[model samples]
Target chain A: MSTEQQTIDPLTPVLSADWGEKRSWTRAVYETGGGYDALRRALRDMTPEQVLTEVKESGLRGRGGAGFPTGMKWGFIPQENPNPKYLVVNADESEPGTCKDTPLMMASPHLLVEGVILAAYAINAHHAFIYVRGEILHVVRRLQQAVAEAYEAGYLGADILGSGYDLEIVVHAGAGAYICGEETALLDSLEGRRGQPRLRPPFPAVAGLYASPTVINNVESIASVPGIVRHGAEWFASMGTEKSKGYVLYSLSGHVREPGQFEAPLGITLRELIDMAGGIREGHELKFWTPGGSSTPILTAEHLDVPLDYEAVGAAGSMLGTRALQVFDETTSVVRAVLRWTEFYKHESCGKCTPCREGTWWLVQTLKRLEAGQGEEGDIEKLVDLCDNILGRSFCALGDGATSPITSAIQHFREEFEAGMHTPAWELFPYRASTVFAPEVTPA
Target chain B: MTQQSTGTPPISAEVRAELVEIGARYPQARSGLLPMLHLVQSVQGRVTAEGIEACAEVLGLSTAEVSGVATFYTMYKRRPVGDYHVGVCTNTLCAVMGGDEIFERLKDHLDVGNDETTEHVDGLKDITLEHVECNAACDYAPVVMVNWEFMDHQTPESAVQLVDDLRQGNEVRSTRGPRICTFRQAERVLAGFPDGLADEGPSAGIPSLNGLQLAQLNGWGPPPGRAGSDADRAEAVADQGRAAAQATAEDGQEGAVATEASPAGTKHEDAPGTGGEAK
Candidate 1:
C-alpha cells in the first residue's frame, strides 16, 4: 500500500508566500511586500474584458470545492444588463476537513481584500461583500480591520488608486449555518433570509443578490487573483496540469506530523505532500485519506500516488475539492470516522429540502446504531440504499456529499461496518471516548 | 410591530442605533438580520423574546421569521449561556486527536452535557459547554475555543485547567489573541464592529506558518521546475536554515525583553460597538 516517492518539483508558494512574515496580516506589511500592485496594474493598464480573458487563460478554477472556472463565472454575468452586479466572497469555510480559508484570512487579510477589489473591477462591481462565518470572531475582526485599512488607503471607496473605478467592500458575518457555504444559500443569507439554497437556472450569475446579476467566488479563488493578475496568465498557467492550472492551498490536516496549509501547484501527489509534511505522525502508517474534504469519497493508501488535480482525482472516483487532505492512520476506524462526519452533516444540514433535511437525519440515526453495534444483518445494505436514495435526489450537493462517506466507507471497508454490527466502536478504539453517548447524571 | 413582550425591557437606545447602522450596511435591511441577532445576543445572554421582537421590528419581518433565523444558527443561543461558552471541536480530525476525550472529561467535570449551561455556582455559573463543529483550526488539533477565540492544541489536563481558571474567575487568555472576553463581548465583535483589539496578538501561529517555513527551508520557488541544480538548491536551503536559526535567536532575545517590559501584559477591554459608528 506504500506509494513510491516521485521527484516532486520544488514547491511553488504563491498565495502563501507572505504567510510566514511577521505581522503579515497588517496593511503596512502587505503593501511593503508588493500588495495591491496587481490591482493597480489591472485597473490602470488593462480593460475589464482583458482582465477577464487573462483569468480564463490562466485556468484558475474555483478554489471553493466546485472547481468551476473563475473567469467563466465572472463572464457569466451579462454585460448588456443595465442593473448593477455584485461580488460576494464566500469566506464561510465550514466544510468538516477544510481549514485553509480561515488561516489564509487570519494570516493575510489584505491579500483577500486586494483580491476582492481586483475581482470587483473585473466584473464591473461597485459593491463587494465578504461573508465570513460568525464562529471565527478573531478572523472577522481581522477582515474588518483589513477592509477599513483598504478604505482608508483609497484602495476601497470612491475612485480607488485614482482610477475611475469605484468599489465598496463589506465584511458581513454569517450566524452559523454550514449550508450558507453553498453559493446560492450564501446569497440568500446575505440578503437576510433563512440561509437556504435557491433553485438553479438563475445560477447566481444571471440573477443574484437582490435579483441583480452577481458573481460569487470563494475566499481563496478571489485571494488568488492579485497574484494571477500581477504575474500574467502564462505565469500562472505554467504551473500545474493543463486544466487545473496555478498553485492552490492544499490543507493537509489530521494524522500528518506537520498539519498545515501547503501551497503547491495543482497536480502534486499526496505522497510528495506527505514527505513535505514530515510524513505521517511518527509511528503511524497511512490508512485512508480524503483528497478533498469529507464530502469527497475517501481514498486509501493504495491511491496515494494519484495526482491531486481535478481530473486525476475525479478519474480516481473522488474530487480535488478544496484540497483538504485529511489523513488517518491505521488506528482510526472507518466506521467511526464516517459516523463523526455524518453527525456534522446532520447537525449542519439546513432543513430546506427533504432529501437533505430528512435524509441526513436518518443517516445519523442509522450510523449511530451501526457504530454502537445495534444494527441488524441487512443494515449494511440499508445504509447503501439510504445513501442511494439521497445521492442525486437532494436539492443541493449537501445531500449528495453526505452520502459520499457512507457509500465510500462501505465500498472500501465493508468489513469494518460489518464488524461494527457486532462490536461497539469503543471496544475497537478504547481511547476514542465521546460525550454523545455518556450516561446523564444528576448534578450533585 | 408584533406585540412587545412585557417581561423583558426593549433593547437600549444604543443597541437600537447600532442595529440601525448594521441594517444600513446591506442594500436590503433584511440582510442585517444575522448581525442584528448577534447584537441582541451580545446585549442579552441569548436571543430573548424581546430580542427577537426587536430584530423583527428592525428588519420588518415577523417574530417567527426572526426566531427561525436565530435558532437556525448554532452560535445564537436559545437559552441562557455561561459567561464563557467553551466549544471543543469534536469533528473527525480533532476527535481522533483526543478532542472527544477532552469533551467527555469536561462534561463530567462540569456536570453538563453538550449545549447545556451549568447552574450558577459562585463565579462560574455562566459556563455553557458545547461540542462545536470544526472551528477551522484543525492544524492545531483538539482545539478548544472560549468565547470563539482559539485555544489551540488542547489536552484533557490543559482543557480542564482552562475551565477551572474560567470558573475561578482567573484571567484566562486565548493562545493567539488578547485576554479572553465574555461570550457577549465576543458576540459584539462578530456583529460587524471591531473591538479595537485587532493588533493585540500574533495573527498566525507557528503551526499555521509551518508549511511555508518548510518551503523556505527547502528553497521552494514560484516557478515549479526551475529550482536550480541539486547542489545550488542544497546551498540555498543551507543559507535559509542559517537565516532561520539566527532569526529564532533574535526572537528569543526579544521575547525576554518583551516579558520584562510587560510583566502583567495588557488587560482585556470591554468596548462594545455602542456608538455603532460604521468603520
Candidate 2:
C-alpha cells in the first residue's frame, strides 16, 4: 500500500526554479537567471503579432481551470479597436484542493511579473493587472515587493528596456471572493463591484476592462509564457501529448507521502504521480484522488493509469483542471470526503445564478443527511439529480465543477452511502456522541 | 431644450475648501472618497438622502453621481441597519458545514428573517441580521461579517460564543474554520439544532438541485440597487417631473419641459462607463 520514494524527473522548470532560494524576489537574482531576456527578445526580434503567433504555435493552454488555448483566446481580440488593451493575471486561486498559485507568488513572483510584461507586449496592452485574492496578505506583500523590484529593474513601467513598449503593472488585491475566480466576475470585482459573474460571449478579449479588449490569463498560464518564450515552442511541446502540450504543476495532497506541488509532463499518470510523490502514507491504499481541484470528478484507484491530459481525462470522464491531484487513502470514506467537498461548494456558491446557488444547497443538505447516517434509498439518485440540475444550468462553470465530485464519488462509493442507510451515526460512535448530539442527551 | 442640469452644480466655496482639505491627504482625489464616505457615514448613521446630497454638493457632483458609486458596492447601505449588522455566508462550503444552523440560531435569537432588523436591546434598535450570500472566507466556512469584520470557523458553539462575545461587546479575531472534519460522526455539532433540517434524515440524499433551484429555496435573489445608471436617473427625473406636476397642480401654473429621465441602460456622457473591472 505504501508508495516508495522515487526521484521525480523534472520537466520545464520556470516557476519552481528559484522557489528554494531566499530573497528570490530581488531583481539581481531574477536577472542573473536570464529573467526579462524574453522581454528583450520579444521587443527586439518580434512584434506583438509575432509574439502572439509564437505562443499560438507553442500550443499553451490556460493553466487556469478552463484549459482554453491561450493563443486562440489572444487572437479573438479585434485589431480595429484603438482602445487600450489590458492584461489581467487571475491570481484568485481559491479552488479547494488547489493551493499552488499563491505559493508561487510568495516564492517566485518575478516570473509572474516577467510573464505579465511578455503577455502584455503580445496582446498590445499598456496596462497589466494581477488580481490577487486579498486573504493572502503575505503573498500580496511579496508580489508588491516583486513588482517594485521589476519596476526598478526597468522590466515594468513606461519604455521598458527602451523598446518604446511602455507597460505599467498593477498588483491589485481583490476583496476575497471565489466567484471572482470566474473571468468576468474577476473583472467586475476589479471594477469594485461585488464579485459576481457577468454574461460572457463579449469575453474579456472583446469588451474587457473599460470596454477595451482585455486578455485575462491564469497566474500559471501567464507565468508559463516566459518559459515558452525562453525555451523554444518545440521544447515546451515535446514534453506532453499533442492536444495538451507542456509541463504542468500537479499538486498532490491528502494521504500521499511528500504531498506538495510536483511539476511533470501533462500525460503523466496518477500512478506515476503517486509514485513520484512517494505514494500514499505508509499502510494506506490509494482510494481516490481529484484529477483537478475538488471541482473536477474524483478519479479512483481503478483509473490510476488514466493519463493526466485534458482529452485523456475527459475520455475517462473527468477534467485535467488546474492539475490539482488531491490523493486520498483507504482511511477516507468516499461519502464523508464528498460531503466535505459538497459543503465547500455550497458555501462558496456566490448566490448570483440560480442553479449553483440552489443546487449546492440541496447537494449539501443531501450529503449532510447521508453522512449523518440518515440516508434514504432515493438519496443517491436525488444527489445525482441535484448535480444534473446544477451542471449546465448555473451561470458559471463553478456550479458544474461543484457537481463533479459528488456524482463521481457516488459512482465509486455507493457501498459507503448504502452502509449509512440503516445505522444512525451516533450509535456507531457512542464514545464521540458529543460530536453530534448534545452532551445532555441520555443514552437510550 | 433641457432645463435641468445634467451634472451636479459647480463646487461652492465652502464645500470646495473641505474637499481640498480632504483631497490633500490622499495620493489621488478619488481615493479621498473612501475617507469622505466614512466621514459622511459616521456623521449620519447610514447614508441618508440629504447626506448623499451633501457629499455630491461637497464633491461637486449630482446626487445620482454619488449615489451611483455608493450603491454599486455592498459596504454602503441604502437602508438603515440594526445596531449590529450580521452578514452571514450562505455559500456552498458554509452550507455543508452547518450554515443553516448558525443562520437559524441568529434568526431565532434576533427574531427576524433575512432583511428585517429588530429594534435595539437598550437605546440601540439599529441591529439587523441578514443571511447574505458568500462573504468569501471559505477556509473559515460558516463565516459571518459583523459590520465589515469577518468571524470565521463558526460552529453552533462557536457562532453562539461569537454572538455572546459580540453581545458582550468583545472584538473577535478573524480565524480559520475548523480543520477538515474526521467524519460526520466525529465533527463538532453546531448549537441550537432545529428540526426540519433538509440536509439530514430519509431525505438525506444528494438532491438534483441546480443553482436556480437552490437560490429559490434558500431565498437567494439578485442584489439590491441593480437598476442600471440611466434607469435610476430616469426614475429620479421622472420623480422630479411628478414633483413639478404636483407643484403646478398646487400653484395653478402650467409646466414646461418635463425633464423626466428615460428608462435605464441608457448611456451618460459625463459618467465614463464603469465597465470592465474595478480599479
Candidate 3:
C-alpha cells in the first residue's frame, strides 16, 4: 500500500467531490475534473475479463439496500450464454430518508453515465438502461442531457473513443411505484408489464430484462465504477474497511441539525457522522436512528458508535443498507413513527404475495389502534404475529421491510406502545414540538 | 391515490404517433409501455380507456393488459388532474417533521380532501391536492411537490402561503430553482422528452452538498494521499472533452444552506418551552 493510503479522513468525498463545483453535471465540467477518463481508459486498455477482474478485486459492495458484492454481481453474467447481456442502473432512489442518488444524479450524472459505460464494458454488454423514478422531473432532465452529451462526446454509442467498443444507454423513467425499485420488478416495469417481482430461480444475472443475462446495480454503486477504473482496484480498496471497501454517502436526515449527504469511508461510526451534522439539531439527544434506510431495522442511541459497515451493522442488529441514517430525537414517538412507516409499507405492498399484501394491512390496522390509544389487550402481540407471517413469506423485501420498523420499535420501546393501550401518542409527545414550522396563530 | 374518471377521451393523432415513437425505443415493443402511459397521461390528463386502447394498438398488447399496467402505478391517474398537481409528502420521516401539518393546512385552505381537486373559480389556481409518499427529498423534509418540482423545507404557514401564491397566479419556483409547471408538462418530460430547463437550477442543494461543504470547510477531501488525485487533476486539465457544452452546477445561486434546519413546528429555539401549533 502507498504511504499516503494510511491517512484516512473522517469524511472522504469522492463521488460527491464535484457536487459543489459549478455545472458539475455537464460533460465539460465533469471532464475538466477527470470524468470520462475512466471510460476512455477502460475501453482502450482493458479487456472485458480484465475489467471484471479489477472490480472483483476492489471488493466494492452494492450501495442499494442489499449489501451484495458489486463486482461479483458483474461477474455473475454468463458470458457464454449467447443472449446479449444488459446493464441496468437502478436510479429509483425512493426509499424513505435515502436522498443520496437523486442529488448525485442532479449534480454529476456523468459520473453515473461514465460508470454505466465502464460497467457495460466490463460485462461485455452493449445495451444499458438507467430506470430513474418519474417523480424527480429535473433529475431526469439532467440525466437525459448528460447521456446526450456523452453520445456527442463519443463516450456512448458505437466506436467510443477510437475503441470499437459499442454501447447504448436508454434513460428510462419509471412511473411512481416504490415496488418497481425492486430489481425484478424494475425489469418487469422496463418491459412495459405490470411491475411485479418475478420468482428468482433464474435471478437477474441468469434471466432478467426480456429473459437475458442482466446486471442491475444501484446508482451510487454503478457511479463508483469510474473511480475504480481510473485508479485500479487497490486504490479503491484502500479507503474502506477490510471486507467493505470504498466510500459511501450516509444520508443523515430527520431532526439532524445539518441533514445531508456525508460521503465517508465504510465502517465510519454514526457518532462521528452525527458530530459532523452539528450534533443532533443542537439540544436534543439521539433517541433512535436507522443505520441505513428505514427498511433495515432502526438503531437506538446505544448504536451511536457502531461502525456502519455491512458486518458491523449486521452484528449490531442492522444492515448497512443504503447508509441512510435517519436521526430521530426524543420528541418523536416510536409508536407513531412505526405506524406511519407501516402505512407506507401497506400502501407500497404489491398484491402478488398474499402474506405481504394482506399481512401489512393487518399490521397497520393493529398499529393504528395502538397509536390512537384504542388498542386491544393483545394488539402488540398481534402486530408481531402479523409481522412474523409477512417477514419471510413475502415475494420480495417490501413486505420484509414493513416489519423492521414495527418490530424494532416494539423491541426497544415496549413501554410507549403499551401506554398506547390507554393514552394517545400525542399526549406523551406533542407532534408540533418536533418541527420548527408551527402554524402561525390565527386570531379568533 | 385513486382518481375517479369522468369520461373516456380518445387519444389524438399526435399522441398516438408519440406513443409509437416511445414504443420503438425499447428492444421489446411492450417495454415502452410505462413511458407511453406517461405520455398518454400528459395528453389526456389521465389514462383514459381510449388512451389505453391507443397504446395497446401501438404495441400489440390487449386493452386489459394496458389497463393493468396503467392502474398499477400511482402516477398514471385514472381521472382528470388539475392544472397543477400539488403533492404533500406524508411519508414516515416527512410526516413527523410537519408534513402532516402541511397537508392538513393545505386541505383546510383549499377546501379539498386528499386526492381531490379545488374548484376552478375564475381560473386562479386549479390544483389537485394529494398526500404523496416520499419523493426522496427527506433532507428537505416536509417537502411539497408542485408537479414534480421540489418545494422543500415547507412549514404549514409556508405551504399555505405557497398554495395562496399559486391560487393568485404568482410565479412560484422550486426551492432548487426552475419555475413550476403543470403536472402534465412534467409527465411529458418524464416520458423521455426534455423541456430544455435542465439548466434552470442548482445542481446540488444544501444538505445534498452539506457533507462536501463541511469537508471543504474543514479542509477535508479524498484522503491525504490516496489514489491519483494529483495526477488525475493534471490529466483532466490536459484532456478535457466537449468544451462546447458548458453547464455549471450553479447558474446564479449556489446551494448554500437556507435555514439553520432546526425542527419545524416551533417558532424559535431560544423561546421558553416548546411553542405550540395548537389546533
Top lDDT hit: 3
List chain B TM-scores, each candidate: 0.77, 0.50, 0.80
Q: Where does model 1 exceed 4 Å of error?
A: A1-9, A432-444, B1-10, B224-279
How much lDDT does each candidate structure score? 0.80, 0.61, 0.82
Candidate 3 lDDT over residue span A1-444, tens digit each: 242536766777778877665566788778887678777667766898888888889898999989899989998899899999999999988888788999999988999999999899989999999999999988999999999999999888889998998999999999888999999999999998888999998999999988999999999999888887776677678788878998889998888778889988898998998888887775677799987778989999899888898999999887788888888988899989998888888898889999998998898888888888888898989888888998888999999898898888889999999999998998898899777564433334
Model 1 lDDT per residue over A233-295, tens place: 766777788688888888888888788878888888999889988898666688899999999
Give the alpha carbon lDDT tens digit for every residue of A1-444 in model 2: 111332223333335544432234446545555567667778877899988887898799999888899999889888788888888899988786566686567556788998999888888888887887644434555677778778887888788888898888766655435777889988766664456788877878999776779999999889888776765565456567779987777766555545556556678888876775566666557778788877888888889999889999999988889777766655455676677677766766778888998888888888778778888889888988888898889999889988998888878877777766866433443322211112433224
Give fnat, all candidates: 0.56, 0.01, 0.71
Cα lDDT, model 3, residue A271? 90
**TM-scores of the candidates in the order shown:** 0.89, 0.64, 0.92
DockQ of 1: 0.30
Order by TM-score, highest first: 3, 1, 2
Q: Go through the candidates in order and give each one's DockQ.
A: 0.30, 0.02, 0.34
Please identify model 2 stretches exceeding 4 Å from their true place.
A1-11, A424-444, B1-279
DockQ of candidate 3?
A: 0.34
